[model samples]
Target: MPSPTKETRTLSPLATLPATMQLHPPPSSGTHRTLRRLQSAHSLGAKAAAQPSLISQQRFQAQNQQQRQQFQRLQPIQQKPPSPARRHVSTARSPQRGRANSDAAPVPTTTQLAAMAMTATRRSALSKRSLAADSMSLERLLRDGPPNDDVEGALESARLKILDQGIRSDSDGMSSLRIYVWLILLNAPVLETDTYLSLIHRGPSPAYSKIRNDTFRTLTTDPLFRRRVSEASLIRLLNAVAWTLHDTREDRTREPSIASIASSSRQSLDQLSSRPGTGHSGYGSGQSHPSSPAAKNRARALTLTTEGSETSMAAESGTYVQGMNVLAAPFLYAARSEAEAFIAFHQLLTKELPGYIRGAMDGVHKGLALVDKVLAIVDPRLSLYLLSKNLTAEIYAFPSVLTLCACTPPLPEVLRLWDFLFAYGPHLNILCIVAQLVMIRTKIMDSPSPNKLLRSFPALQADQIKRTTLAIIKMIPDDVYAEIVVHAR
Candidate 1:
């Protein structure tokens, strides 16, 4: 179909018509607007067409002017000749600096470039590996978590049994007495443990001769207990310490079960004393000495004697304080290759899983509040530590409560907490420290500010520590998990 077109009219007098005119009726308002638009567009087209011509003319004028200016300037130079000295000076200076080796010809092979590139690549890789090795080392225990699958299951079972046994209606479980016993046993020398074990087998007694006799026999049977400690070595010698400190035969000399062992040890001690004894640095060079008896007594006194309750333990069962002290140098050394594995574990637990699903997340405001609360009340020492250490986000992301401080303090305190961590891992141990600290806070709150609190905690007992740590782990709600960014690691 053909398109429709309306008639056109102009406001000019010739375009206008008399009142009776009909051949082309006057245009409507719509047609007038269309004509006005067309007229304006035509005018715009003319202006656009004129711009290029103007520009071309300007260029032509510019070209002519530039040629004239160049001709005028070059006339003087053309009239003169270059000096010989100036030519020589230019040639000599430019060529000397630009030449390669002054004798060798140019032209590098593609193969040579490829070989050079390969060498550069290899050097870069080697440098990267070296830097990685130095900045961060491999610590397997921290990286790998507990190796024993059985240990993991055992800990869970132990947790259940403890919770069932000790938890009151309103609360979670108390600390496991068995673990407390075990930790103390772990810390004490094995020889002493054996002696004490034997003594405990017998009824309690204070008989000097009888006790000495029992202690002597126990040491003979337990040949593993006599090894010396390596001061320079990095890993924990738990079994070694357990073997040495646990020689308690003297504690129960009269008891029937290990009575003979004590009698033998005592007899041996007396014989050595009577002989004026000898000194031994274990590499076996020593001379019989006059003061041997007194020295031997002092040596014997050093053994850990857990007699009556197996209950007498170190004053402190460290959680954050000790971990806060040592952070985790010993365990990472012991479990040298697995440190990153723990960091990864923390990253997952504390980061990926949002707590909102659990309906406990209080959004950003509430989340920040809880974080502040934990930092403020959980351990005042942590703030001082955070301030002093200038903890980075990477550090706070550390899932373990101890983070860097676990191994910071004295040997005894660090080991006690480590025994718990090695036995338990981050989940229970870190949580319980918080819960336990909260429980005992009233007692120790006023003694020191955050910095001084560091000193007060190392003296805590094993049992008290266990109970409180468990409570915290069992009670922390799923909601707040979002706040702990370290868990994702």
Candidate 2:
């Protein structure tokens, strides 16, 4: 039997199996045997699906054991709760310090009361005089107010803290506490999920799906924990994630970040994870393949469609996507693959959409369609977003994920919608985007009309574009969401 050529890899299973298919050749004996074996293995998959190859299982077990050991090693240095004796000891020390803390006596004054009053009055008047000045005047005025040698030190600290916060926001891994809380959270009889244990013990593995799915069943058992992780809170979490993804170039480049709208978030170092071995996980250490049959099918239907990464995103929008490319490149490629899957999902949703949803998300659908065309050359269903309409000229949907939430008005509400989009399927997120557009339709339409300043009103950054998109989506009836819940996503 002749060896199969590279072209064979290009055809899909259904396409290749049919006599009408011409791209792939009839399988040679060796190729035929390979196909038969693949079919046989696939048939046996349901039985062994819960398990894996002995090699993989053993490796997983050993990895799990090592993770347990590492978790043990990582267990935080737990502080013992204060005992009564310790309280007494602290009490005993307080009075002795208090007695010593006071100054012994007052020194005699050198100046008169009138001079002191005059000095104080002059300084007050001078402060008022200085404030009513421009930059240069303010600079000179600041010099007159007080000695500022330590101001340099204070400024340096501020700079350092700012840099640290920036680092924290971008971190996807350990920046501060993740485990200390886990250790305590895990031991509480009614507080934690086995989900906490699995990550700590196994790191991260592709095999965690079953464990996580099982854990999901137990999530409601811990009422307090459930409340802590409510949809509202999860939306807050997504907001954090959106912030974490913040790139200065994208998020705050155009508009000033409204200080009033956003609270300053410092990186929390005092996490429950201050204690070691508390909550970290080893699951997801292994690579993740696409889970659904469609994903697998998509893999076979390979394309050069690059995943939507900051770079590719920037390229599409004519901006330089910041950050290290290596870390982001793989994900971008994955996004391209994700986009392909999204288009296929979009196809399914289009077939199933209720009349209203189909009508409302027209532009969003158009965007998805555009995404499909862009990725069609590579493969469709890469990293497509069914973006809700952004009608305000003040802000269009910001390009990168970092900038997306930053540009929205009802940001907290917005991020909650984004959370499930990424959480479920990568490409299937188009539905959530569409849903949000519908949700915000009225707010957008009521906002001031788009600036007609631009020659092309329907441009990407058009003022009413988002609202128009939303209005379009508003037409989708609730019944359309059934498809979203069951299949679209």
Candidate 3:
């Protein structure tokens, strides 16, 4: 009932609890003590949380002070500024941030390095072989010895020699034995001067007008071809070929039919029977029934027609095609005389490449397709890239296929490429074309418009092309290569 003192008033009601109650507190008092403990813990946690930031600030200040002290110690030492050029060089050598790895060139893998090494070794070996081959002259091989009894064996030996050791020619692509070697490879027989001259005298052939149209443009840009072979000689040679083809066609058409021959034979039999037979019964008598001379002539003509019809039809159809002039240009430039050129050219069209010169030129189309296929097999990435640009071999390889790559420039290199072609197989020219594409693949892939770069191919590099061609050969499948072999047949 007494009034409360200031001290009691200041104390909390819970603090005024009896001593026994304090020792054994009620549930609510326990809750209050727990809340106090929690508050104490929360305060401590807050202080701990703030302590790290304070510690970090102190550490930062310490670091700043140390750096200042170091700067003060080095303040008296002066360094010269780099020159602009030196600074530029240093900056260039240094890898920039975020692009340090990007600027560094990736190291080649083991397989790639091995491939490069093998290529170098192969190139060195080829160089050595070429040197050795150059030492053995094909001319000396012929001049030093009498003609071999076995002509075919001798030709095979010469071809092998050419394959192993390319023909040696002057910078102009002239060699004493080049024409002879070509003749041998082409299997052209010895043609007489009179034979060639007689064809020339036959006057303008059915194809003379066409020949004139093409002759002026043949090798027009090639100074070497122009320097050696005149348009007149090319005209004569082609005209002579045309005449030979025309006569051959005439002979084929003039052959007697089987029915006519049979009728003539029957008439001859009737005449013999009616004229003067010892007996009425022709066969019963001692006389025998022999074949008439007319029948024999007819039979021989029939055999001739049958045997030569396929080749005659094929050759006659292509008496002269547009590209024939370009085809003959190389022969004229190589041959010592027009007659030789005519003979070799005729042989080539009639035998080695009849399908090529044919009106349809099916062989050339086949060759272009094969070029695409072989490229796909050998270098698929490049093949796909070209395909992505809608660049097929047909667009760029027509001239190459039709002319056996004579369409490319540098007459000397064409001559060199031809040597290999004649020695091995002209069909290999498809691979040569693909080889050219492979050589310029980098430029083509980097180009925005690859077609422009392909419109006019780079100048011919005979050695590089030959090497690349040889390398590509191993990568081609046998079936694909077989098609390549006969695509230009």
Q: In model 1, what is the error at residue 413, expressed in angstroms? A: 6.0
TM-score versus the correct structure, for each prediction: 0.25, 0.18, 0.58
lDDT, candidate 3, at 277: 3
Candidate 3 lDDT (Cα, whole model)?
A: 0.57
Error of 1 at 392 (Å): 14
Q: Estimate, for each residue in 409-477, the C-alpha lDDT of model 1 and write its tens digit.
A: 233333344444333332333443444344444544454443234322333343445544433332233
lDDT of 2 by residue, 1-489 (tens): 111111111111111111321212233445434433333332333235453343432343354445435423422222222222111110011111212212221111223223333323322211121112212221232233212333222222221222112112111222122121111111111112232232234332321222233223222332333333343322222222122223222454322232211223212211111100000011111111234465344322221112343332221111111111111211111122222222222222222221112212222223343222322222122112211222221122212111222122222222222221221222223322332333343443444532121111111221122222222222233334223333311
* Candidate with maximal lDDT: 3
- List ranges where model 2 is wrong by over 4 Å: 1-395, 398-415, 443-448, 451-489
lDDT by residue for model 3 over 56-142, one digit each (tens)? 333443544454354334222222222221111111112223322322322233454344344333322111122222344577545
Error of 1 at 322 (Å): 15
Stretches of model 1 off by over 4 angstroms after superposition: 1-155, 158-231, 235-372, 375-405, 408-424, 427-433, 443-450, 482-488
Worst 10 residues of 1 by lDDT: 1-10
Comparing 2 and 3 on lDDT, the stronger one = 3
Say which prediction, candidate 2 or candidate 3, comes out ahead on TM-score.
3
